[model samples]
Structure formats: C-alpha cells, structure tokens
Target chain A: MTEPILSLRQVNKSFGPAHVLKDVDFNAYPGEVMALVGDNGAGKSTLTKCIGGIHPIDSGSYEFDGRPVRVHEPRDASALGIEIVYQDLALCDNLDIVQNMFLGREERSGMVLDRASMEERALQTLAGLSVRTVTSVRQRVASLSGGQRQTVAIARAVLWNSKVVILDEPTAALGVAQTKQVLDLVRRLADAGLAVILISHNMNDVLSVADRISALYLGRMAAEVRRADIDHTRIVELITTGRSGDLGLAPEQTGETGDPDATPAAGGSDPAGEADAIRPGDAIGPVVEPAGPAETPTATDTDDEVPA
Target chain B: MTSVTPEAPQLDGPAEKPAVGGPRRSPADELKGHLQAYTARVRGGDMGSLPAALGLVVLCAVFGTLRPAFLTAGNFANLFTQGAVITTIAMGLIFVLLLGEIDLSAGFASGVAGAVLAVTLTKHGWPLPVALAATIVTGVVIGLVLGTLVARVGIPSFVVTLGGFLAFQGVVLIIIGQGGNIPITNETVLAIQNNNLSPALGWVLFALVAAGYAATRVLVARSRRRKGLDTEPLVVSAVKVAGVVAITAAAVAVLNEERSRNVMVVSLKGVPIVVPVIVVLLALGTFVLGYTRYGLHIYAVGGNAEAARRAGIKVARIRTSVFVICSTMAAVAGIFAASRANSVDPNAGGSNTLLYAVGAAVIGGTSLFGGRGRIVDAVVGGAVVAVIDNGMGLLGYSSGVKFVVTGLVLVVAAGVDALSRRRAAASGA
Candidate 1:
C-alpha cells in the first residue's frame, strides 16, 4: 500500500473512567477518500475529535507526511494543513459568506478590513469549486439553505489550501440534489490530490465514494480493507460482531457475538455470497416500502453509481 | 445545478422569484430589488431601523403640535446637552450589548469616575488634563477588573457587573465623604456645558460635517463599484447626501436664530460645544464598529462564540476588550455629566442614567441578544429618550408619568426585537 499522507497509530483517548477511543489506528492516503464507518458509540466522533485537536488524545502517535508530529490544538492542526469541516458547520448565521469565509483570519489593509481583495478571493474560491447554488457571496448565512451552507463550509475549508480535510457527515441533513452536489464536491477534492476522511453512517454513500474503507467496533479498529475487496454484508458483520470470517478481529476477544437471529440471516455461512443471499428481497423488504419519488434521489442517483 | 429549484424543500423557500438574495440585479431594478428584499425581510420579522426612526418622527410631530416651545432651537439645544451624557454611556453600552453581555454597574461606574475627577480637581488641586486622565484611567481599571472576572474567571457578566454596581456606588459615596456635592470650578471643564461656537462658525462646521458624510458615502460606493460589487444607484446616493445636508442645514438655522427677549436681546446662538464632541464620538464609534477587522471579530464572537473560537479568534481577549471599551465610555459619560451639571453631586451618575442608556440602545433597534446592533442605535435611542423627557416637562407631566411612558416605549421596542428574532429563526430553521 502507498504511504498515507496522515496516520494515527494506537491512538488512545479517555474521559476519566470512560475509554472513548481504544488503541485506534487510522490513516488516509493522498488523492484517496477514506471512509470511517461505525455504529453509535463506536468512537468515530471521538477519533475524529482527536484528529481535529478538539480533544487531546490520552496517548497516541499522530504522524503527518510519514513523520511523527504533535497537534495540541486546532490551530496546530490548521498550521499543519489539516482542516476539519465539523458536522455543525461552525458558521456565524449573521455574517455574510465573505465574512464567514474569513471569520477569524480576516484580511486587512492597515487596520481596516480589505473588503475588495477578500471579496475577490472568496469569489474565485467559490468559482473554482463550481458552487452555483449560492447565487451571491454577499448573502448572510442565515438566509442560506442547508445544502448551500454545506457548500460554503466545504469551500471555506478548501480555500486555505489544506493537505488533509476531514468532513464529518457532509450529507447528513441534505436533500437528494444537495447531497449530490456535496458528493461531487467531495470527489473534486480527492481528485485535486487532498486526503479526505469522511465520517458517515450512510452505507450507500461510503460504498459509492470511498477508495478505502475502515470499520471500527467498540472503540477498536476492526478492519481496514481496500474498497474492491469488501462487500456490504462483511462490513455489517464486522461492525456487529467485530469479525468477518478471518479478516477482522476475533469475535471471541469481544466476548459477545452479534444478534444471533441477525447474524445467520444477514451474514451467510459462505463469505462470498453473503451480500447476494441477504439482498434481492429479505434485506430491503421493510426499508424500501413506499419508495417512489421520495427515495429517487438517494437511491437511483447514487446507488447505481458505485465506486469503480 | 441539476435541480431547477435549489432551495431546501423542508425550509421556507423564497416566496418571490430568483431576484431576492439572488445574483446581481440590473442597474435599473437594483433599487426596486433592494426595496423588495427589505420588505420581505420586514415581513419575515427583521425590521432594521424602521421602528426607531418612525418613533422619532411621531414624537417630534406630536410634541411640536402640543407645545410651541418644544420645537424651538433653545429647547433642542437644551435637549442635546441633557442627552449628551446618556448618549455617551449608551454608545459604550453598544459594545457590551453586541457581545450579548451586560454591565449594570456602568451608570455608577461613571459616577465613580465623576467623583474621582471632582475630588482630584477640587481637593487635590490637580490640572484639568491630569484630573480627566485620572478619571478615565480609573474607569479603565474598573473595566479591567470586571472584564477579567467575567472572561478569565468565567463569572457571569450579570453577576460581575451587579457586584461592580454596588461596589462602585460605595466608592462614589466614599469619595464624596460627609458632604454630598463637590462643585467643579475649572474653566475648561465648565466650558463643555457653557460654551458654544459663533453662529457663522456653526454654519461652517455644519458644512464641513455634511461634506465629510457625503464624501465617505461616495467613496465607499465608488470603491464597491470598482470591485465589481453591487452598489446603490448614483441618484440614491445623491438623495442620501442631500438628506444629510438638509437636516444639518435646518439644525444650524434653528440654533443660529436669536433667542433674545423683549427687555434684553441676548443671542444664545451656535451649536453647543457638546454637540460637536458627540458627533465626533459617533463617527469614531461608527468607524470602529463598521470598518475594522476587530469589529468583525466582535460580531463573530457575539453571533456564536464557540464558532469564533473554532475559527482561531481570541474570544476571551475580544470579550475583555469590549468590557474595557464600555467602561472607558462610561467614564467619558461621567465627565460629560459633571460638565453638564457643572458640579459632581452624589446623584450625578446614579438614578436613571444607566436605564436611559440601556433603553436608548434597545429602543434604537439594537438587539438585546447580541450579534445584531449598531452604535447608531445608541444615538437614535438616546435622542428618543431625551425627547420624551423634554416633551413631558414642557407638557407639565410629572416624573411618574415620564417613567411609565419610557417603560412602555422600551417594552414596545423589545417586542419588536423579539418578534423579528422569532421570525428569522422560524424561517431559517
């Protein structure tokens, strides 16, 4: 495998008695999208927080460009060209796009805000990103739709020319068209040769965009596999039972198997046909009910276009 | 780009076509578009300076009809002096209010500064500049202590300033000692209230001020257009310039009129010294809050402090600096108060001064919740308060009626603020 642009090795974090992250190992290569997938309490957020420097890890080695480095704060991470587009977007609703784009790091001309240059740069960045939904950079964020706000937030992160950008649920609250816009933007980011760590619960989104998939279960890294080598059933099995045949961590070590009913029904005895066996009717019967125009965007637009 | 309608389906979509919040409008329709957008916003509950402006016009019209003397130049000049101290204090409070914080002690803090000035000048026999400097420094010191406690120590600003309010009042009492009044006799200090420029000089000053205001608007409009940004039409800009000229010309005309009586013709003409000082302060306040990076930081911090912190802004420092500015302005207000009264009495900075300042800020359309106010709010709101008091006095209404009326005005302003905020939230959400 090619060396990753950013890596975290045996990263451990604790909140007093609660061990939020347990010896977590993660990495993202340059020019590739790494999908971090997990269920609730799987420590995906804790891990990302550690990476973003919102929380200092209890013990871990964070490496950048294949060299060990220390990131004690968000500023430190920013200095190293690591930017996190947080789930909340972290934008001021009262400020305009140009102001929000350069919130803290405002450009100035001898004590006054340099509006012309800043506005020009902001316009150039949005144009480069091909963001057409936002009609004006002068519009206050309070007036923007969710998708447009997400676009602005992503544009802001990429505007600083960061080497690695971590997006936490970029499409969680978006409409079908907005999600497509964001996913396209995501691909453009990776195509431009920036490392991207996408944390998401949407399995279809991950499978469609991720070049590498890393699954975490119970605060531990269960498996790190190339996108081509994995299937949906194996990933779900690894998430629920912490093992998918011999590839993942042994199930015995976890001391609890996944739901007995769900395991046999979902993860078939044969590893290769598990996805096929579970699909066709049994898996999607309930979830796909009344699926018409409502599901058309997320289902048809993205589901048919899986990663090559 | 794929969807014809890009707006969120769940959220409130724009009612009109693509013109509102859309890309640039044609130069011919630019003004109309702005008006449409403004009306939409107002309907959506974001009434900007409309209420304060409307209230001022109504008050003037009503008071002018009721009392002939209410519209006189002498009465306005007197109102200007009375509003000066409170306006200065309100201007400083704008900084505090912008951060979604409050300083209850500001009124008494100014009293403390005034007391210090009085004692230093009268008892210690210090020079005017030295006394003024000491008074301002004392105000800064008070601000530093309060700001540090609130920002660094994480105490609630309400509680910190409440403590400051009581403690500073004590300091004021102590400085006054057994006697209640410490009269100020310095010629320069006295001049702040007693002096006025000649009628000719008032016209020149009026011309200069009007010219400056017009120049700034023109320069900003030109720069914005040069950068390919949207700007108001030249006719609209010209209208605004003309409006300022007309207002200043009328004010100068009234003030320059002779106030001579039948027995003795004494011409009490020209703008008061305090008017120009207040104008300068307003200009500085507007510049700092509108044009500087630090001002942008202030807005960002007020809007969402956590977001500002994530953006690498020094949130604590910004919060601290705002408090310092508030306290320093409070000190300036105290000096003005002493100068207006020509004495430093125990009742100088206490009583309803703080309330008036805060009321003026809110009444002027500044949001109490922070992230949405301007220094002009203080000026406009302060004038509203002064006019109410002055008008009531002319009508022979007691202080009791005045307080009740002022309270009602405050409630109405607050209601407007609350209603608009709720509308914005409902639509945004």
Candidate 2:
C-alpha cells in the first residue's frame, strides 16, 4: 500500500474503561474500495469515528498521505480531505437539495445567498459524479427516495474534494433497484480517485464492490483479506467462523491446497485471486462455527450469492 | 464506472450543460417535463391563515348586517386602528414562536415601555422622540436580560419569561406610581393612529402596495423561469397577485362606503392610513423570515434544535434575538395603542392585553407548538378579533359577552393548532 491515503495504526478507544476499540489498525489506499466488515458491537463504527475525527483514540495515531495527523473534530477530518456520510444522512428535510448539500458552508457572494451559483455548482457536482436518478435538485429531501438521498449525501462528500470518503451502510434501507444505484455510485466514487471506506454487514455488497475486505471480530481485526483472494462463500465463512478451514478459499483450490504459495494463480481476474496468496495449511487454527446440522447458511438467503 | 446505467434520466440537469443543441438530449427534454419541484413552503397544509382570512371577511359582514352601523366608515376605521397594535405585537411573537418558545413578559413589557415614554415625554417634558427611544431601549434591555437567561443560562423560556412577566408588571406599577392617567400631549406621535393619512394619500399609498405586490410576484416568477428552475405555475403566481390587488381595491372601496344618517352625512372614511403601516410591518416581517438565511436557521431550530445546532447554526443567538424581537414588538404595540387612545392609563396593558396578543397569533393559525405559522396569520387573525370586538360593541353586546366570545375563539383556535400539528406529525413533516 504505497503511501496509503489514510492509515490508522494501533488505535485504541474506551469509554471510562468499557473497552470499545482495542489496538485497531486500518489503512485505506486511494482508488480502492475497502469494506470494514464486523458483527454487531465489533467496534467498526468506533474505529471509523476515530478516523473520521469524531472520537480521539486512547492510543496510537493516524497518518494521512505519509504524515502523522491529528483529527480532533469532523471539521478537522474535512479539512484533511476526509468525509463520512453517517447512517442518519444528517439532512434538513425542510431544505431543498442545493441547501441540504451545502448546509454548513453556504456559498454567498456578499450579504445574499448566491442561489444561481450554488445551484449551478451543485448540479455540476452531481453530474460529474454521474448521478442521474434525481430529477429536480429543488425537491426537498423528504420527497426523495432512499437511494436518491444516499446519492445526495455521497455526492456532497465527494463534492468537497474529499480524498477519503467513508460511507456507513449507504444501501441499508434501499430496495433492489435502489441498492443497485447506490452500489454503482460507490464504484464511481473510487474510480474518481477517492479512497472509499464502506461499512456494511451485507456480504453481497462486500463481494461485489470491495477491492479489499477487513473483518472485525470481538473488538479486534480478525483479518484483512484482499477481495481477489476470496469469494463470497469464503468471506462469509471467515466472517462467521473467523477462518475457512472446512471451506477452502474456493472449490477449485479445495483439494490438496496445503501450500497456497505453491499455487500459481487463483483465477487472476476474480476478487479471490489475492486471497490465494494466503499461506495455507500452516494452522487450521481453532475456528468457530464448525460445519453442523441445523445450520444451513445457504438455504434461506435472498440476497445474491449470500447463503442462509 | 462499473454498473451505472446511462439510461437513467438526469433529474436536475442544466439546459446549457454538456453543450446544448447537439443530440436532442433526454436530460434536456426531461428538464421540460414539469413537476411540482418547488414551493416556497412558508406553511404546509393547514398551518397558515386562509381560513382566518375568510373568517375575517365573514365576521365583518355578519357584524355589519346585525348592527348596520358596525360597517360604517368610522367603525371600520376604529377596527383597523385597534387591530394594528395587536398585529404589531403578534409580528414579534411570530419570531419567538419560530424559535419554539413563548414570551409571557410581552404584555407587561409593553405596558412598562408605554408608561416610561409617557412619564419622560409628557410628564417631565423630555423631547418626544428621544423619550420614545429611551423607552424602547429600556424594553430592549429587559428583553436582553430575559433572553440571556433563556439562551445562555439554559433556563427554560417558560420560567424565564414568566418571571419577566411578573417582574415587568411590578416595574410598570413602579413607573406609573400614583399617576392615575398619563396624558400623551404629544401631537405628532398621536397622528400614527388618531389621524388618517388623508383619503388621497391613503388611496395612493394602498395602490403602491398593490403595485409592489404585483411587481414582486412577476420578478420572482421571471427569475425562476430564467434560471430554468422549477417553481409554481405562472398562473398560480398571477392568481396570487390578482388576489392581493383585488383585496386592496375592495378594502379601499369599503372604506369609501358612505352612510346617510338623520343627524349627519356619513361616507366611508377612505382607508385609515394605519392600514398601510400595518401592511408594511407585516411585509418586513415576512421578508425577514423568507429571504434571509436567518429565517432558514429559525425554521431549522424549530424543526429539530439539536439537528440545527449540530449543523453549526448559532442557535443560542438566534433564540435570544427572537425573544428580543418579540418584546420590542410588544413595546411598539404598546406605544401604538397609547397613541390610538390619545391617553395612557396606569393599568392600560393589563392581563387582557397579553391574552389578546396570544389569541391573535394563535387564531391567525400560528402553531402554539411552534416551528410553524406566518406573521400574516396575525394580521388576518387580528383583523378578525378587532372586527368582532367593534361589531359586537356596536350591536350593544356588553363587555361580558365580548369576554365570552374572545375566550371561545382562543379555545377553538388553540384546538385547531393542536389538531393541525397532530396531522402534520402523523404525515411525517
């Protein structure tokens, strides 16, 4: 990760002694979508907040673009080109699109709001990001669909020239079509040369868009798996079991995969190709969720490629 | 870059963007596709005073038919002059209401300022305008203290303003002392309410207001069209302007109505000049709440104060300013009322005056719950209350009857505010 856009090393946070984040290390490289996967209470949000400048880490530090940095507030994070669109979206429903987009920093020529300039800039920002679903930028957020609101929030962050964009569950509330729109937007944000950190519990989204995936288990980073090295099945297994002993990285590598290094390449084009670099067979390592009866992970799943 | 479909239509695309006129674009055609994309949204649903405006018109007719003399030029002039003070105070109250608070001290503060002015100007022979300025400043100081307590100290506005109400009423008594009636011998100040703007000036002033309204509507509509921004239909704008002009012309005609009496010839008093003054105040208040970001911050504070604060608005300052405006307007109303009566009694602005101020705002469709309502609501609703008082008095209804009617109107108006709030909340505003 040649001078990653943002790096959080040994970050620790606690609320008076109820340890929340414990020595968390995370890094996001420019132009790559990294998934921060975790179970409930795994401190994913806490770790992100530390990076977002919403919380001060009890220990460790953050480095941005090769220099150690201090982010004491969201404004600091913003000035450092870091932007986070939290789950709530923080939009004023009474305000129109242009107003909501520029809630904190309004563009003014003098004493008056330069409505024409703001509207023009907002439209340009949205267009530059290839956001097309929204018809009227003057419409209130209350009238927007969930996908459109998410798009607006994401567009607002990118419009500020943010170098690192963090999105917490951008598609958590969307339906099928809407989710597709948001996932598409996520891809474009990274492609536009901004490092994207996506926090989601959904495996399909992680599999579809993430270039790299880091899983958090019990307040510690369990593993950071490059997306090319693991498919959805292996990723879910690691998320659920903290290891994929019984489930090989893929069916093609299932038999005689004692040495991952011995294998030439695991389908070079696929996201699982990087996971194939994991040195195999050294330690199966006391993993949880041993294949058991009454635990069929695949049967009841509705999301694409995610088992029950 | 991955799965974004170009087939998806652009919602807020600019016409001149991406080089216009080259391939008849969907984004361009889509811009032509009309939608109810924008509305000023000063009020949503039933939060405004269309009902109150209609009620005002009907109340006048009913009173006129019942007493016949109730709609005479002299009585109508009396109604407008009376409504002016309440409307003025309610305009101030609108600001406090926008910040989701109430100022119980307004009535007493109003009395205190008027008493202060009377003592300084008429009794001590201080320069009239200077004395008035001193009195208004005192009112502002009192307001500043209350505002500081409510905003900086984090004391609830209810407790702070309630304390102010008691303290200021005591102060008013101290100012008035043993003086039973303070005669405002100032002739120039009396003209604001006592004398009309002379019928020609009155009519011309009203015509300018009408023209102003028309020009503003046209300008706004043209600006929206020029920007290719979505706004209400042009016909809606025209109809709204036409409605104002019609109302102005009708009011002037009504003031021009004459009644022939056995004792003397009666003709409409030709629009009390105070009407235009009241109109100007309402317009100023509307402008502050509409075009300015300060107005936007007020709505944001009222809607969800925590959200507004997090958005970095100076909520405390905005909240303090609102209370100050409210109290200052109350002082303005006090002085206006004193001039209208041509004399100021020691106990002039009693509990009833404050109650009527609250009632005017509430009945005008201002939500007592706050975050909603318009200053114009007070103008229309104050007109209704004044019409009722004058018409009922002319019909020989006793003061007791007036009290009962006023109480009933307050209860009904508050009930409406509650119901409308419940509906809006249910609809997820």
Candidate 3:
C-alpha cells in the first residue's frame, strides 16, 4: 500500500482535566476513504479538530506527506492543503453561492472584486462536481435547499486543490436522495487522488463508501481494519464493548471477557421497523452498559489486539 | 391482457403546466412565474423597500391635502435640508446595525464634534480645514475607545454606547462653555444650509447625476450579458433608467418654481448644498456596502459570527472597523447639523438628534436585527421623519401632536417589519 498522505501517532488532547483523546493513532492514504466512526462523545470531534488545526494536541507526532509537521492554527492546516467541511457547513446565509464559495479568498482585480471571473470559476467547479440541483449560482444561501448547500460546501473544499478533506456528518440531516448524492460525491473525491476522512453516525454510509473503518471508544482507538474483514455485528461490538472476540482490545486489558452481551440479542429479533422503533435514547442504555467494562483498556492490550 | 401505458397528454392549455411536462415556457408563463416568486418573497418577509415607498406616498398625499403649499418645491427643499443631518447620522448607524450592534452615542458624539469645531474656530483662531479635521479626529478617537471596550474587552455594545451617550453629552456641554451658544460665521460652513445654486446649474448637475446612474446600470447589464452571465432584460433596465430620469426631472422642475416675487424675486430656487453633500455620502456608503470585500465581511459577520470566524475572517477587526465608521460619519453629520442650525450649543447632537436618526434608519426599512438593510433605507427614512416634523410645524400643531404622530408612524413601521417577518416564517413552514 502507498504510504499515508496524513498520519497521526500517539495524539493526545485534553480540555483541562478531561482527556478527550488519548494515545490515538489515525492515518489516511491517497485515493482512499477512511471512515472515522464512534458513538456520541467518543472524541470524534476532538480528533478531527486536532487534524484541522483548530485544536493543538497536547502531545502528538503528526506526519504530512511522510514528514513531521506542526499545525498550531487553522491557517497552518489550510497551508498544508487540509480542509474540513464542518457539520453546520459554516456558510454565510445572506451571501449567494458564488460569494460564499469565494468568501475569505475573494478573487479581486486591484481593489474591486472580479465578479466575472469568480462567477465563471464557481460555475465550472459546480459543473465538475455534477451539481445540477441549483438553477443559478447567484441564489442566496438562505434560499437553497439542504442538499444544494451541502453540494456547494463539498465543491468549495475540493476547489482549493486540497490533499486531505474531512467531512463531519455529511449526511446527518439529509434525505435519502441527498445521502446517496453525497456518498457518490465522496467516492468521486477519493477517485480524484485525494485522501478523504468521513466522520459519520450512519452505518450504511460508512459501509458503502469507506475503504477502511476506524472506531474510537472511550478516548481510545478500539479497532482499525479493512472493510472486507469486518461485518456490521463486529463493528457494533467494537463500538459498544471496545472489542469483538479477537479483533479489538484483548480481555486481559479490559479485565473482562467482553461476553456479557455480545450475542446480539436485538439483532435477529423483530422486523426492521420494530428495531427502528427503538428510540436513540433508549438504545443507548443497553449498548452503553456493556461498554462500562471496557472503559479502562490497558495500553499493552491495545498493542496486542490488532487484527491478525 | 395487453394493457398499455396511456399515451402522453397532448401539449395544450398552459404549455408550462405538467399536462405536457415540457421544458419550453411562454413569455406570459414566465412572467406569471416571476410574479409568483416575487409574491412569495414578500410573504416571506423580504419586503425590501415596499413599505417605505408606501409610507412616503401616504405622507405626501395627506400633507398635500392639508396644505396645498406642502407640495411646493420650497417646502421640499426645506425638508431635504432638514433631513440631511439625521440622514447622514442614520447612514452611519446602518453600519453598526448591519453588525447587529447599536451605537447609542452616535447622536451626542456628533454633538461633541460640532462643539469642538465651533471652539477650535472661534477661540483658537484656527483655519476652517484645521477645525474640521480636529473635530473629525475627536470623533474617531471616541469611536476607537468605544469599539475597543466592546470588541476586545467583550463588553456589550448596548452598555458601552449607552455609557458613551451620556458621557459625550456632558463633554459637548463642557466644550460649549456652560449654557453658552457659539454662533458660526464661517461662510463655507454656513453655506451648506443657506446657499443654493442657479436654476440652470441645478438642472446641469441633476442631468449629470441622472445620466451617470443610467449609464452605470446599462453598462453593468451589458457586461454581464456579454460574459454569458445572468442579467436583467434590456427592457427592464431601460424602465429603471426612465424612472431615475423622471424623478430627477420632477425634482428639478419643482425646485425651480417661483416661490415669491414680491419680497424677493427668488424664482428658480435650487436645492441646498446639504442635499448634494448627503447624496455624495450616500453614494460612497452604497459603494462600500455593496461593492467591496470589507462590506461583504461585515454582512457575513453580522449574519453568523461563528461561521465567519471559522471561515478565517477577522471578526473582531470587522466589528471594530464598523464602530469607527459609524463614529466618523456621526462627526460629519454633526457638522451638517451645526450648519443647519447656524450655531453650536449644548443642544446640538442631543438625545433628540439621536432619536431622529434611529427613527429614520428604522423607518427606511433597515432591519433592527442586522444583516438585512441598505444605505437607501436611511435616505427614505430620513425623508419620512423630516416630512413628519415639517408637516406638523406647517399645520401649527403643538409639540405634543408632533410627538404622538411621529411615535405612531414609528410604531406602524416597526409593526410592518415584525409582522412581515412572522408571516414569512409561517408561509415558509
């Protein structure tokens, strides 16, 4: 495999006394989609922010393009061709699509904005991404649909010739068609030789677009493996219990066998609709209860538990 | 059973409708679509200047009926001059408003500035230019102090400016020497209020301004079309140009009418110098807000500061710069105010002046919520406030009547703003 274009080793970050990320290791290669998945409050945002330079890691070694680098600010990340499309999209509602796209880095001639050239470039970029939902680039962001705004954001990231693109929940609020469109766009981004890090809560989206899956549990890297080697049940096990038989942290470090509720009691039960009826808040209790035993995964176990 | 799909419906009645499901649209159908879209926007609380335009028309009709002379050119020239200072101050207030910030000190800041100008000239024996610069600089310093306290120290602008409002009012009184009024005798400063150009020169200036505006509109449209970009149709552009020409012609014709030949043969009275000064300021303000990068950032910061910061904009710097702009413009407005009154005193740039300026900006359709207003709002709003004041005085109404009527106009204007927003949200849902 080609060397990773971006890699983080032993990255640790904390907010005062709360250590949000601990000894975390992550990497993404060229032309690959690396899916970063975790439950709520599993350090997904902290880890992504570290990579985007919005938060400086307390201790870590970051390697970009096979060389050690320091990213102390967001501009440094941008300088290194790293872009993050935040969950809220970070778009100005009052400005039009073209204006929002070229906002901070407006194209100008002398002192005045070169609207003609900027408009042309915006149109071409949209076309390149096969975005047809918007009838006009001059339409204000406030008037755009959710799907169109997402498209504009994705296009903005890629337009800068970025090498690494991180998307935070790209389809969290989207309809089925929008999800499909964004997933397809994600694949095309990887196909264009850029490393893509997709952070998502949707299992189907990760399964569909991720070349590899990495899971975070309790501020620790629970499992990282090829998409072909892991199934939905094993991924769920890694998420809930920080282990799946031999795939994740060993039993000795967890101080338990990880078998208390690993049988997938809710997996094969009722119809899909019945399972879907399980409210998010209610489901968290059963899934998180088993995770209590795996909270203190030892460093030695994490080292030895890599999938063979 | 050999059931077959029904044949596609033939293209008839309403070619744009789904019966045929074709992309082709007739001009009438396109016009219908445009009208529907426009109505939807209005319903959604994006009324633009519709309410302001209507308010102006209603005021004119009522006032003209009460006194036939109210429609005369002399009264309009007087109204324009009266509105100048408030309009100038309101223009600056729009900058602060666009950032979702308020500058309560704007009225008294200008008052202080006018006092400084008066003292520097009468007591210090300074040149007119020196006095003007010194007064303007004082305004900048006051703005800088307020902006820093608000932006860097993180004090709420409402609190900071409110403090400044009272502090500056006291400062103005001190500068004018404890209840003393300083009469301004400088010809250049006094001319802004009293002087007028010849009738021919007025027509020439109006023609030049009108032509320039129409040319810009046409040129921009042509360039956009040439670049294969979207632009308004030629007929629409022509109609807009025609509207400008008509308004300019009417104003010039009315201002040139003979007011009185017995006392003084004052036929062909032209617009006051203050009118042109306001126009120049408006043009500059519009250019900054609409055509510049800094202006774009102001809107973005006002709309969503978090998003703006994430996008790498210097949100603090933008916020600070706007306060400075507002204060500097307030100083200029004070000069106009002093000119109109022909003197500087403790009364200059008091709370009343600030109230009028705020009223004008709000009446002009600039949203109190920010990120949704225009420079033109101050123009229309200033005119509305001035007309109210002027018409009431002409009718020999008491100050009480003036206050009630003006208060009602402001409430109605604010009601229109709030109601349209609520209705838009409901319809959008």
Q: Which candidate number would show the highest TM-score if scored against the true structure?
A: 1
Q: Who is ahead in lDDT, 2 or 3?
A: 3
Cα lDDT tens digits for candidate 1, A186-275: 877898899999999888788888888888876667777777777888888877766686655544334353322211111111133212
Interface RMSD of the candidates, in order: 6.9, 7.2, 11.8
Q: Best-fitting candidate, measured by DockQ?
A: 1
Tens-digit per-residue lDDT, B1-429, candidate 2: 112333334333333443211233354344443322222232334447866777787887788778887866667667888888878888888888777798888888888888888888888999987988987897688778888999999999999988888888777788777567788889876877876565677678877888888887777667655765555555556677888888778777777555224336533355665677788888888877866677777877776676567667888898888988888888888888788877777675675777778889888988776677788888887887888777888888899999899889988988988875665443323
lDDT of each: 0.80, 0.72, 0.78
Tens-place lDDT digits, model 3, residues B1-429: 012212123211222232111244655675565567677677678787778878888989999999887888779888988889889999999999888899999999999999998888877879999999998998899889988988899999999999999999889888887879998888898999888777788888898889888887877667665676655545556777898789878987877666554546454377677876887898899888888888888988887788888887999998888889899999998888888888999978984688788888888987777777889999999999999999888889998888888888877877877786566445432
lDDT of 1 at B41: 71
Comparing 2 and 3 on TM-score, the stronger one: 3
Question: Pairs clashing in candidate 3?
Answer: none
User: Model 2's CAPRI class?
Assistant: incorrect
lDDT of 3 by residue, A112-173 (tens): 77787778778777766555556678776776656667778988898898999999999887
Question: Which run of 10 residues does model 1 chain B get worst, by summed lDDT?
Answer: B11-20
TM-score of each: 0.87, 0.80, 0.87
- What is the model-wide C-alpha lDDT for candidate 1? 0.80
Candidate 2's C-alpha runs over 4 A off are A1-3, A127-135, A143-148, A172-181, A231-308, B1-47, B253-273
Cα deviation at A118, candidate 3, in Å, is 2.1
Poorly placed runs, candidate 1 (over 4 Å): A1-3, A14-19, A57-61, A252-308, B1-25, B262-265
Output the number of the lDDT-best candidate.
Answer: 1
Q: Candidate 1, residues B1-429: lDDT per residue as tens digits?
A: 122235444233322433213466676798886667768777766676778988999998999999989998789888889899889999999899889999999999999999999999998999888999999999899889999999999999999999998888888888897568998899888888777878888888888999899998988878877877766777778887898799879887887776545426555777888888888999999899899988898989889998999888999999999899999999999988888888887766888889889899999988888888888888899999999999999999999999999989988888889888888876654
